[model samples]
Target: MKKLKILILLLTAAISVSAQGFEHFVTAKGNQLMDGDEPMRFFSWNIPNLNYVEDEMEFGRTNPYDLPTEFEMRDAFETVKRMGGTVIRIYTIPVRNTDFPEDAVTFVEAPGEFNEEAFKVNDMMLALANEYEIRIIFSLLNNWPWMGGRPNYAAFRGKDKDEFWTDKQLIKDFKKTVEFTVNRTNTITGVKYKDDKSILCWETGNELESPYSWTKEIAAYVKRLDKNHLFMDGFFAIDGRTTVMRESLADPNIDIVSSHHYEPNPIKMMKHIDNNLRVVKGQKPYIVGEFGFASTKGMEAVMQKIMAEKDIVGGLTWSIRYHHRDGGFYHHSEPLGNGIYKSFHYPGFHSGLVYDEKDFLDMYRRYAFEIRGMEAGVDEAPNAPKLLEIVESHDIRWQGSAGASGYHVQRSESAEGPWEVIGYNVSDAAIQTFANFHDESAELGKSYYYQVLATNQGGESEPSNVVGPVVYEYQALVDNWVNYGKAFDSKDIELVTGDDRSFKEITSRAKGKKGSEMLYHVEGELVGFKVYAFEENPDTSSLKIEISGDGERWNEADTQTEVYASKEKNYAYQVPKFYQVSEGENIRYIRISFQDVAQIARVELLYK
Candidate 1:
């Protein structure tokens, strides 16, 4: 059997090398990770790796750590395959032996102490990977919870960063574990499984180096043991200096440069990838080891853009286990316990291909197949227009999917290249279009660009083509006052301060329709008081101001604050600190009587 396995590996190696056609690793001059071969996208449904298999037992008697029966493993594997997934990343490294009477067993490969039960679990996972003919990236170490196969060991927990870097024994055990897995083949199942390409890659750890590292010992160890298989030293682009992470990958031992891409801003991710690519000396394949669309601001659009680029070999979203009731990744919903980790459904992994409860899979099934080297359909983009134009006051709009939450509309003077975004606006369902502005700031005569994007519950749509004559002029300043008018006074009631003692003490029963006085609480360390008014009136350049601290001490009539009334329609007044009340003083009413009649609407008080 060993001899037969050797022969198969030799043949497979020859085929793989020859089929590559191009260089072995990514190069700097051309595209990085991707080359002649069609890029392959990988997806992983990571189990948080905190709950031990023993803890997950149906009954205490039956050892749950044993490998899932072949039937069960196949069922799980086939589900992912059906969902159009090409790979799976599992967190199966065991952390403890509860039966041990001494200190909890911490090492993944303790000297002579081997856990057959734990091995069985991993064996099933690998066997299933082969059976389904899907690639697998076995993460060598799970996150903080189950570090190096120890249950709840503080040394491995996320917060205990010091030990993982400093502990000599822990480092030794980690190296041994990788050595054991890469060297030992699974023959216990009597399956003809050997080192197959289906076992695509091995990851050092998931989201490692976030807390910072004192040593590169773990990476060094993997390089020494598995020279044949590629090493994906994990990185989370969220916290680390991306340049540093890319530099770490430059080590001769590291075969693939891997990083996790999770940013709300699409442009940020673009800049990040570009920056990291700068120092990666020669050409080396870079992988966004994991990324996802759940709560990940612009995931879908970003992924679509990145994947379309021929340079990016392939990338993986968070997971395939859409129904991990036990939870997974940065965000996880409920899990489906029906003997399967359902991908689609409420509360499951939001990043699954199939809905856990419903059979609905993403329409991008064709895209998935394409990544795996299958013939695919021509890019069938919907007939959404490339550009849209609207008058200055009107909104630019469009209808799109339920997954779109909002769109970004960018504008530029030139129709050809660089564009600056005026603002990112929301999709107003009431208007039936994703709307945005080229407001009063928009210039007339000059062609200004306009675009609309549909946004949904999941993500945003691509921007539309630039549109516009998109005129912007003062929309007939007809009753410009009425246009921006607001009133704070009424004929029926008058705002008054009964006495001078009422200074700064706003009293109710003094004012407009309901006679409800709006009081300003000058509490705490407040410095001063300010009142704002909005109006859109014409022919008014000056206004008479009235002041009454406590309504009784009327300072007659004064022209304190003035306005050119410009073409805009807002006015403000700062009630002087001299009019301010002490802790014991009772200050009140303030009234503004315009000497030149102008329209006024809405009023506000601001702290200075």
Candidate 2:
């Protein structure tokens, strides 16, 4: 009788724990994703910066990849919630590359060595997902070398990239990564990652071009370590192939299959989705893990097909970037689109006009709610913006609110008290690289505390963090490229416009090639001037600046300009050089000559 009672108690305890585990996780049920007992479907986004950031393009910052702060993580989650999204597929966890700077941060520092600090950020990401009731599809590795990927893993053993799949030593090193990630405990929640409900699935890698043999072994390994979460095969070819391998479909360990669609043709994209749906019919749930960079109509057509198909569980847009903790949105000009479309932000902005970002996001929000069989009600007021820095009266920057359309700048004599409105209805979207509002009305010599309130169609957010005691120093003439001819005289300069970090507007910059020169007519007693230049290669590019009292006689300004060259070659590098003039130099005209292709974003001339 005693033995019988003990056996029954043990069985009941195991059942209870199993039941609790299934309550929150997303499970696969033969072509359907189940949330508890109901089917789960969503139209969502891919947030690449959810864990690690690669777009930290702040001025003078050498290294780009850093662990995102809690503020940044929360902002991304909140943006997804506002967009009516339930799931967000984050980019792959970073691995350290041999060529990376010694100080560069990566999640997998070595074969079995994980960075605790990097993983802590990931823990916070999962914790936020749980708090926000959002599900995450965490990718484990990368096939591309954007952040360290398969090549880096192979390099560790001094083997070729192809060996990562077939080599025994390389496979062992990868499995160790899998085991560590699956069994690691979340510092905040004190729950193992395998048991966390916030994770929707664990993708093998980001758009990996892995062979079937490697995926099968890795998928089984992941399932062995994690029985609660579903495993997704991340094998994909960039050539717009939509069908999953038969080997992947037959594997018991692979619970979900996905395909990436970048086909610009709407009919082709839909046809591809249908082909995958037919292939995975009744075997496992299928998802369009990533898709976009098509026309608004084309993307809408793809979304319609995903929603209409019973077997297609969900689809995430190519990507969405959120507000950076330091201030402004993390910008990535998608090279695939020829640098025309940047990653979409919540509620959209004019910066993404070429890609129909505003219209597409609206469509995404509507579809995101519709697919879930729910109505998207009125959006709430945006969260408060963070006041990042007050460079000067003319150069004010802040971290943008997710859904905010514009901002109102207020000034106060003291930190806490009666404030005066200095600037109203200022658009942060007018500029790229940073969210800026020039306080032109700020009087010289008057030191005042400043705060900003973000506004949108929904409502206004609370005041941003206070930046104070800023004394207006000089009356400055700032040209940000919009009115190019008004500030500088150069016909050889071409006005290049699009979603590029090099071009700043509200004033846009001038693009100059070799033998091109621009002359700026200085209106005031020139104190000093700072030139913001974007050079592709500083080693080969040179810009000469000379001052002339008379239009004929010119003297070169004796100043050395140091521009930090980044290792990443995809984006344009900003080289901001400041030249100081002695107190009483009668300078009338400033001439700038470009020796190589370069973009001059802005020129700030400081004067009394």
Candidate 3:
């Protein structure tokens, strides 16, 4: 027993050291690869591990019992090949043991047994990849709702199960999993799989950084694994520049920079792209690993323009499976079922490329098909906006719409690049009227570029002037606030006046919920105060409030006045109401709250 234990320990140590020694280098042609080869542009389906198999099985009509079967993988790979896809992305972390209860492999700890079912499935997948000439980008770490450990006795965990950055048990489980994958040569029908040219890359994790710390540990660990495949990590570029990219690239183990872009406007999406490119500075290769096109307008043209550029490798849309839980919209082919695929419960997410009998291939053809390549270089010159045209300005607005939601304008002096967020349409003027804003502060004699984007109910509109880069130097920062999700409730307005004694900043309270209130602090003199309520909707019924001076002497705003509907027939009240100052003037503190019990929508404030 002691000799056997020593052998196992030595083997484990050998695996860890083997994983850490490899270094990544670029090919002469500038493609980012593990062994310095061109990455074959491919499309892949993200198959969840044993734990998530049930969700996919039940909702997506996949049969996990036959998952490792040769015929099943061959059929799946063939289908993908028919759709022009060249790769498959398989998940390694199983979410819940229940997702595959009948299966022999389990992440849960039982005794001294090991469940090698995951390894078996992976072997089948690799065989399929070899058969179909499709590459595989396997994710190593456990993702989302699953914890990791041993077989029948593994430590299965997710982000919530353990602190992603500091969980020791989870880390150890991952290290073991990697060792198992690297040391074991996969077998499909008695054939060994290793050092195969068909395996494209080894991805570190899928969609990491819900808070941004997971990447550091996971990236480092992956570097300690097999050196044969290029290491990639997934990231979402939502706000700010690529702060996360800078941190990830600092570790030498990371081979290529990858990110997901989903902005409404082509120009806006390009902003993220440009920002990422600037940070990378071409030291390594970069790719927009994941980007999506809703049945919308902007991205098609944007993609067409990008297809003409050489630096970009390619991007994977969302999921490749024609399943319902993921809103199965078929991009490359038509749906196989008629009334066969329908959401049994929540139906809001319709993100699939093919939907019931519909031939949605045109959508894919419109963007991905006709793409060609061109050299990459920026020309620095007139830094001003061109074709600065407004597509559609609307009187009404809603969240996530092209003409209805919001607008954004950007300016850059170099024209070659480095565009800055000059202004956004969230300003009081832009919200009220979709008008052009001219930044008089723009310095003369220097070139500038500018572009305007409109967002309405569907999403942001395609940026108007995408043909040429726009230039602008003069700009201003607009001050405004918006209702984030829901209208303010009565409890939110009335609860504040009771006993709180400090001059509290109301921004935190108003966050997430929508309503209007005075933004500037009223610090000086106060002879009278009024709450301006806008009767924007008909459902509003009541209002609530609280007042305080010196953080004491709390008095509630008149509940009667707050409860009244709009002076108009609608429940909303846009007019302001005057309230007499109960204290002897020189009011240093004022807190008035308003909530519409009936159908509160928009509110404002008027004070003197």
- Candidate with more favorable, higher lDDT: 1 or 2: 2
Model 1, span 308-385: residue lDDT tens: 655455566544322112111111222221222222321122223233322223434444565666653432222222
TM-score of 3: 0.45
Q: Judged by lDDT, which candidate is best? A: 2
Provide the clash count, candidate 3: 69
Error of 3 at 256 (Å): 1.7
**Each candidate: what lDDT?**
0.42, 0.79, 0.40
lDDT of 3 by residue, 35-95 (tens): 3443433333343321223222111121222233343344345544444555566555443
Candidate 3 Cα errors over 4 Å, as ranges: 1-52, 55-69, 95-114, 146-162, 189-194, 210-221, 235-244, 264-267, 322-360, 363-608
The TM-score, computed over Cα atoms with residue i paired to residue i, of candidate 1 is: 0.45
Winning model by TM-score: 2
Q: Which 10-residue window in model 2 sums to the lowest lDDT? A: 499-508
Which scores higher on TM-score, 2 or 3? 2
Query: Which regions of candidate 1 are displaced past 4 Å?
Result: 1-69, 97-112, 146-161, 189-194, 210-216, 239-244, 264-275, 278-282, 293-297, 322-360, 373-608
Q: How accurate is candidate 2 locally (lDDT)?
A: 0.79
- Per-model TM values vs. the true structure: 0.45, 0.91, 0.45
